[model samples]
Target: MKKSLIALAVLAASGASFAQSSVQIDGIMDAGFQSIDYKGNKVNGIGNNGSATSQINFRGTEDLGGGLKANFRVETDWNTVSNKGNTGSASTPVVAGNETVAAASTFGNGEIRAGLAGGFGAIDAGVVNYNTLGTYLTGQPFGTAIGSGFRTFYVNDAQSTSQVRSDNSVKYTSPSFNGFNASLYYAAKQTKAVDTANTVTNSVTTAYGVKQTSFGGLGAYDMQGTTEVGVNYANGPLAASFSSLKQDFKDVGTGTTDQTVNTLGANYAFGDAKLFGLYQTNKTNTSSVNNKAFSISGTYTMGAVVLMAQAGELKNDVNSTKSKLVALGADYNLSKRTAVYFRAESIDDKAGTVQAALTPATIKGADTKFARTAIGIRHAF
Candidate 1:
């Protein structure tokens, strides 16, 4: 009887442990206000404009025994101001309203993961996030308020029709060793194929002009795919990262079949200050030839004040045009989770030339020159 009781106790303990390994919920909530000026017009916009953007993330994991585990996450954006109809809204809606579930596994090495995570390596991917190449080449954080002034939809014929995110994607990550690691990823196309009409001729006519006949074209749904590879390294106070991304669209009518981008960046930190720089190039099969960008930024922290400055240039070879931006900002940290920030930026596009494609948002004033000044508070929980 005692042995049987001991066996039962073990079984209960195992059950309890299994239950403990089930799932957990955690997330962060961020919200803020913002305003901008366009050609002397003060346009005000608010809510989750910066790092304090609103979001809710829920993740769960299961221990599969033998150094293997299964994990999943369902993350979405949450507007603290209004819980309106659903978890998403028209302005700052959730990235993938009903499709934010990511399931993957981790082998014994904790560093290797396979599933629906962000892109491989240093790139982050999801319904709301940009591809690794796009993220790096854009040189902007997930939701940075700055850098939007010069944003463009297509560079060198490469089009970002949809916000960076891929559905039904599989990704893999390698463990970082000595402050270095690599990643590779592939995204599947979830689109359908269609048929079109075409004209063809069998052979040249003997005496009369060659004749052509119309026939139904045999077109299939061209499977689209995206491939991304990146490497990141961080040692001591210095860090660097690079990535390459290729986006392919098949069966689309006469559009560029592929878009390729390359990005490289490095940063160095010195006690209370840090300096960083980035470079990017975009190429496509269309006439837009090549688009290039470069930027440098620095930040210094002293007591309650953190000062920042950044300068960047974007160039489009086809247009023979260039655009430049300079910005300065300051932040006063009230606490670890809260801070007040103010920033101002100046932009210039060569006269009569289209602005560089790299700028995220347009400049606020006439002659492609303007500034943004904001004083806002941010908090995270």
Candidate 2:
């Protein structure tokens, strides 16, 4: 009789523990028609991510004893227009967050993460991303990926390049205290390339970016694996973020050098409107070249409608290069998770010379320019 009672008690405890865990699946379905004019060349067609990036996500959490918890997340990039996947770029094999880099395949793999949280904060291993930092940065006052996205999408070389999703990476986020929180990420390694035997050489060109190899092959670089730090504060209507990122490539020889990027971002809310700004700089430890970029953006809300505008500039120190952009858009909310959006953006390479095929292929080459407009509907579920 005592054995039976003890068995029932154990089963009840197990049931209670299971009850504390939960799992959910959520995603965004976004599609639109876009009309783009690439330096007088025009194309109008169905598009993906009109107002946002379309992706699917699965996440779950389990409550543990003593202020500790276990959590996991997996996500993928999708294109509603072509029903394609996002096969991230050569530089970043798997992208998980707001991106400032390039894309190689039509549909790239996004982020997969698992972690633990407690009084010390949280730690996530894998592609530690929660996505669309670009979406967050661009949306600012009024949230949409298309309108104020010119600053993030159009510029090729900018100081604050978007976050490069790392393959073998881990991140730690501290608990917020006094409206301040910080995050640190250590990107361990890169996904294997098609040509795994390619030695880190000086000036070896890859599908992603040109390698600057020289000096007895003493230097190597890989933009994928790096260390990143971000600090943020929010007290009420005002918020700000500061970040530092460093990229290092493994060495085939000796004296391998790397590069660094630093950024500052801020925003303020005033009644029906909000202001946003960002500035960034990139400096190479081995080279004399440096890059800088900045943007000012805002959004206004009225009833069920939101309006947005943003402008930015990129100055490349390599060859007196300059790129400028402007973007605008509007959105009408049908509900909290459903909306219709429209946006227009333009970019100009003021240097009047296309550099090369490096940035987004849509505006490849030097002295090239383009304008884009998109209208679509978005639903989150």
Candidate 3:
């Protein structure tokens, strides 16, 4: 849920006149108690976002006339109890469940971008998700839907800084036509590849009067740029999306392999239920390392109540191992802006899914299966 407060005013740019220049503040706070059981151990505690992730954000727009507009957005989530920025990731040292409320890492900016939009389409540059995977995801069971999201899923495993989002990126979105649209994104690899440029080195004088040079590019990775393209169709009760993404690196393990991924997915709606499915494949050109995943999910909405379920499988062809996930949950809305939900999910691990490396220390072990249940409240403002 969100609220927008608008203040109208006239504005002129590029010798053109327009009206309605304003800004708005919006955010959501979701928290609740969650429980988890890994193998034979069960742990419970009060955390946050049992139903959704908590976040705060601000966005505004200035009409630039001639069907053009200027816009900016900055969003960051909070740790709530600490009243500080929230850290979306859990570092190995910060996984103690019994740690004090203020022990968690500080919050961080989620996305910040500024861009222009017009009859042709829209363009934005900043920390952004440059991939069009969302178009195909539709009602993805992952994300904030309690037990519906499977962490081992491939769609959530792409971690190349620019996979789903990047620190610096430019994205272009085409205007919709007949329920058809397209998007393209490019994220520059921030690295000084060897003798890259003047912006990568510094000079200092040694005590012996000898000129010393210090290069700040060592260990810098992700040298090549990243590119993503996506197309989607949402007509009537059917919606589908397709995307191809390529991540470039200076040297891909032994001077071989190019990391590339492709995904296709669709969603169909009928009555009070919607069906969603996605398939993805990722490969390294010069290596036998590859990953593939398939997922199916569904949601049912009855007035202010909602139910969700999901199942997925991820396979690592290189190791001939796989992981399976299943989840189910339900949500009840107290009002248009607030809700409560209960969710439970489990991951049946066969071979370790690399994505599970970040699992909290409290839940890390030689467990063949992981499970959890949670109840939470979410309110948007």
Candidate 4:
């Protein structure tokens, strides 16, 4: 009887170990309340409102013989507040007037993977978080929660398309060596054609020989490509990284060309305090203008209270316009995964042609002066 009991116990233990070695699910959910002051008018309300902006990810590994392993990850963004009218909705509408789907899968070697993840070295390709490069270098506070601070100087003239998260991409990453790693990625544009004649409102009506039938053809350009490269070195209290990106679009026969972007950033840490800075420039052969931007930020922690501050400047060479921004924030950490934060920001437009714009906020109307203050709580799980 004693031997039988021991054997049962051992089998149970073995089963538990095998179960632990199988796949696991883990992710984070971030949400907060934000306010904006566009040209002195204050608009305050619950934002991202009850939506978690959450992600569910699964990870597993199959150990092969001879120290080899097959690893995989499948991730997808979820709209936790889909039932709520104001929550889980996109901050902005897409070109197709529909919500975007965030789903990605990666299968490859251990830490060194060659699959769909985010962008290449610094960018994100498939369904991942922000591109590694932007997240590492620019460190823009509003890139995640909000869609601001993701553009060059002149391109942000209060009227430009915001940065977009990539989709349908393949990426490769090298194993980290001494806290250093590199990555690369490519995204495929699955285009389609549309016939406006059947979709038009007035189909069978014609008076002045105006052709109501129109056809638009869309197809992926094989010659077009997006490239990203980045390198980083980190040791103890000091870390730095640099990255660059270039996007080439197939000629649409309208004399419009593709775009290119360059960015550099550095950060130094001392005890509980750190200083970060970044400079980015954007150019295009289609236009005779160039945009440049620079920003510096400082963050310090004191027990449960953390203080943060940042200043930025943007300039346009063709228009000789410039804009300046300043921000200060504080956070009280309730625990490792939860915190309460307060932030205040101000923007001053020095450009005679451009208006003052706020970071992380929109300039919907046409007013110039903008300032905002907000206090919110964020929890990551």
Top candidate by TM-score: 3
C-alpha lDDT values of all predictions: 0.51, 0.62, 0.64, 0.49
Candidate 2 TM-score to native: 0.76
Q: Candidate 3 vs. truth: CA RMSD?
A: 7.8
Over 1-381, each residue of candidate 4 has an lDDT whose tens digit, in order, gives 001112333346665444433455655554456677666567776544121235555665544444444445665555333335323333221222101221111121112222222222222233332234443344443333322233323231111332333334555566568888765655443323231222223565423111112111223222234556656667777676665655554432112355666666667888988887767777766655467778888888899988877788888677887877777777788988677777776666554223232233453445555555656666665
Candidate 1: segments with Cα more than 4 A from true spot: 1-33, 39-41, 45-47, 79-143, 147-158, 194-224, 287-289, 349-371
For candidate 1, the TM-score is 0.67
Model 2 score (lDDT): 0.62
Task: Give the runs in model 4 whose Cα sits over 4 Å from its true position.
Answer: 1-23, 27-33, 49-125, 128-148, 151-161, 189-224, 252-255, 349-363
Reference-based lDDT, residue 82, model 2: 54
In Å, residue 127's CA in model 3 sits off its true spot by 1.0
lDDT of 2 by residue, 245-330 (tens): 77664441222456676767789999999889877776678665466767789889999999888887777787778878788888
What digit string (tens of lDDT, one per residue) describes model 3 on residues 1-381? 455655444433322333357678888887788786665567788767666657788888887678999998877657654444345444222111111112133333566789999998999987666444474356465463455443455543234222345545788989999999999988765333332222222564223111111212223332345688888888999988888887665342223335677777788999999898878887777646587878899999999989988888888888898878788888899998888888888887775552443256566656667777888887888
30-118 in candidate 1: lDDT tens per residue? 44465655545466666443443344444555545554555555555455545452332222111111112222111110111223322
Number of clashes found in candidate 4:
10
Provide the lDDT at 92 for model 1: 18
| lDDT, candidate 4, at 362 | 55
- TM-scores for every predicted model: 0.67, 0.76, 0.79, 0.68
